[model samples]
Target chain A: MNADEDAWERGSGVRVVPPVQPRKLAKVPFVEMADGRLQGVVSSGSDIARVYVSSITAGTHGFNCSTNNNRPCGGLGGSSPCKHLRSLVDEAVLQYGRERVARYLQIEVGEDDHLMEGLEGTRESAPAAVVFSRFLRHLAYLELPVTTEPVAEMHWFPATRAVI
Target chain B: MLGVQLAQLHDGDRPGVAEALDLVAGFDDALVHGFARLGEERAAALTALAGAVAASPLGPAVSEAADKVAAGSIGEEHLTALAGARTALLGAVHDALLDRLDTALGRTRAAWEESASTAAPADNLLSGSRSWLHELGITGWRGVDHDLVSSSGQTLEALLAEPRLRRLAVLLDGLAAELRASCPIATMARLPVRRWADLWTRAVLLSQPGARPAASVEPVTGRLLVLGADVHEHGTAVQVQVHGVLEPAGGAPTRLVRASVAAAKVDTIVGPAVWRLLAGHPVLLTALAERRSLDLADMPLSSSGDLAWQDDKATVGAPADPFATARLQLANANAPAVPPLERHPIRISEPVLLEDYETDGDRWTLDGHSIRVDLDRLPASGPLTPELVAASSACIGLVRWDAGGWRVQPLAVQATVKRKPVEAHTGDWAQGPTDPKVVKAEAKAGDAVAVLRERAGRLLRE
Candidate 1:
């Protein structure tokens, strides 16, 4: 747990800079189904730094995570990074320090640039408006909640009992 | 040839042309005769004043009479008096020519009516066609070659039947009034009497000698209704006309033909044969008339008013049964069984999902995380139950059972539900379906809450 020993950071013996506003981890669980993949809901609380982490990890590493071997985003194959994965990374980085964030992202994903290159290609290829929209959506997804009650609440409703 | 000869003689100045020309000259002579009517002394003085009087030894008396007539004060005795010796001779010739004017005008008008009947209704009755030449006969002589008749002796007899033509002749006659005293010749020369008179005679002869063919008439059968008449006949096919009555099967019907008998008249009647034909085959005619329309429904009526009554008659056509037709159609049709009602597709242009829903008696709640509602107050029937109501806001609701009918539900409702948040846990364990909103908010609150329970459960474990 010692920062220097863990190759995290050697404190100058002065003081570690505490985050002005430390971020919370995403509450939604990421499922990989029967296939060797990863998928999850995005929680609120993640920000740009988390988005950056998620982008690098999922996009560049080509971590085969979707339900099927679905690439890019959602069920459709595309160059842009998946909104859910971006949200996940954003949640992780916001929760942990930069070193820990890097270590965890590397563990979660083998390499970081393969899918990210595709994402970068998508960003370069898409219109500025589209890229901006995707970016904002990804940021929004990062900020979504990942807790049990919230999930249940999101899905909750009276059982649709149709009267004849 | 006569026109050519007359043209050559006229000045073609032929003596006849001059003589015919004399008609006008003589007219002038008669005008001058006025100078002779006054006393010899005054007539001589006026004749000397204008030089219209003849310069012969006997001219004084003629000049005197001419002056009297010109003064408009001549007595009957003065008119009876001749101007010297030549007065009698010129007077006689003028009388003869003036007599021809009536014959001429009458002939022209008669010819015009004949031509007019065949031409447009409004062509000039006086000037159109050969009537113009007939009119010219009185004003100037063209040696028209046709027999010339005298106006005086002509006695409007020839023109009596045509009052308008006679009136025209009288009008033309008035134009040559100067000749009345001297010889009526001047009026004849200026009038349209000659030319029209000749053409009229010809038209009359042509008209009188001819007989028109009688119109065809035959007795007809079946219903008949004359458009504008009290006349109605049944089982008769006589060519009906406004004038003539056709002979009925037994005897010739009363002669109503005289009621409307004008030469070359045209009449019309909606004949009986056509009616019989329609009655005989009503179905075919009706079908033919309606064939072009798209309606596939059966014919509306039978030949007989009642189907039962029709069946009694053998000639009545067979009735078309709708069910039989439908069965035959089904036999020929090739189509798959209609899909079950549940699978029947319902399209939604706008979809809204309720994140949460709950009901406590009357109060309703939607998604717990998002908090939308279905309804609130209980109706007379009962409060809305989540299980009883399926969708909201124009949502398609299909009955779970096969025979049930599907419906649409409205989102507008009076309802509300409670909302709460769940705490976050940073652990190496998976979480079940959690409230998406709470998870999002808790995750955003701080670092320890950052670990995703769902991701840990699915991805890392996998």
Candidate 2:
């Protein structure tokens, strides 16, 4: 299928695999990598990773990603598929070839699972930058003079999806 | 004293009679209204009297009478005229006369005021009298020529000697006393007095100390601080360096030795020890112990003196025992009479035969019979050249001793390990993007926040 069809399928919550091998191209890790526009490093040893891989499209090494405001999208090893993670995977596959990419992808998945558990615990602990930004948003509303009226309403992506 | 002299004067014949009556009316009006307008009344009375004398029928009679009074050629008629007219008009005339009398009296008072300002020759005789006049609301004085009036016309001073002046004086004295008691400094400039007696009373009262203002403050300007520390091993005294802003106590900026530890000492001060103290130093324990307490003016460092390298951190050795002598002199006929040894007794020992040796981790153990050089006596290797001796005599007094292969008292033993000051760089990150790669990689990690700093350039701040 074309790219749009694959995106639609993915959006519909069904995983879609790319069709052609493109064997001569750069080898990428395949721990069920989802496609997001972010780039960053993911480490299995330190259990630290940068997400937002699509942001890496802006530069060779750099990646820009929304952390406190935007939800993690897709790319490397695809849990939230941000730009940084996509760049890390793309760079890893390019540098190390397919076999090493697969091994590292396994490690990345294990690390992602552990990190998700840690994140769950951390949710009940001190607030993350994401939660802090939310708090700041709430505070911003409260701090606005009572006389002010909202000029526009904001809607998240899935929540703003049109009804059939 | 004649009975006829006591008779009333003829109103029509009284000198300046209308003006005198006017003054009496004004005075009574002033009394009723409080003394707020007394100055205006005095001016009015004086002006009216001057006008009346120039225009009234009694004008020439008053002149002739005034001339008689001036010439001291007063008669019984003059005395009778004054006594008979001792009505309200006469009373006003009496007061006007007293007012003129005060003008003359003021000359003497003005002199007393000048004298009081000098803070010298501390007595005045007219103190309580004027204050008494002030209290009784009798603050006017205008005396006519008593001799011309043929009235036992008394001067203002003489009038105050009357029993009435006494009552007023007493009442005023009480007020003056209260003022002198509570507000001496404020009143010091303007206490009123009209007589020699008052001057004397003021002089006595001021001498009582309560009337004198005390010193307002004891100011503290600069402090002498010493910052010296010991090198425990050699016991070679190192003086402290002083530093800080020195402010003069009151007026001019004073020069003083400050901030260095050595600037706080006594006789041991290198420069002839004669330094001028810009300010005094508080006696402190470190000052007393180190003998560093010296006045700011006397800082030896101000003059050309030997500049010793202070705060040398290399001095590290066991504290010297007061009883032990590090060097000793030796004399022998066979060996040339030698100077004192400079090598440390702890660092070196006499030549010895090596018997056994073993290595244990970082430490090495060796056994040998060695010739013991008495630490209290001259160092055994001391008979060396002056240059070598100088090079070997470490200010720290620690020395290394070699016996065959083994050396004693390693020079690098650690003593106090002072923390090196951690250098921290603080400044706004260079203007541009908040990207970390933009900064010198070797530089420390930038603060996670503060990424959005912008350059202000040369814009004038509000």
lDDT of 2 by residue, A32-126 (tens): 12111122223222222221212322112223333322444333332243434444555544433444344323333353343112111110111
Q: Best candidate per TM-score, number?
A: 2
| Tens-digit lDDT track of model 1 for B134-188 | 3322233323211222232122222222323422222232221112211223332
Per-residue accuracy of model 2 over B1-462 as CA lDDT, tens digit each: 011111111112335534554443443332222233345544354334334444544454444533343344444333222212223243344333323222221211111011112122212323333333332232121211112121111222232233222222222323322222222122233222112112222222322211322112222332232212111000001122221112233544322222322211111111111111101222222232332322333222211111111222111122221111111100000111000111111112111111122323222232322211112211111111122222221111111221111122111111211332111000011122123543332123232111101101111111
* Winning model by lDDT: 1
Q: Is the docking of candidate 1 incorrect, acceptable, medium or high quality?
A: incorrect
Kindly report the root-mean-square deviation of model 2 from the true structure over all alpha carbons: 43.4
TM-score (C-alpha, index-matched) for candidate 2: 0.14
Share of reference contacts found in each model: 0.06, 0.00
Candidate 1: stretches off by over 4 Å = A1-60, A63-77, A99-164, B1-462
How would you encode candidate 1's per-residue C-alpha lDDT over A21-107 as one tens digit per residue?
Answer: 123334422211101112233432343212111223222334322322222333224444555555554444443333444432334
Best by DockQ: 1
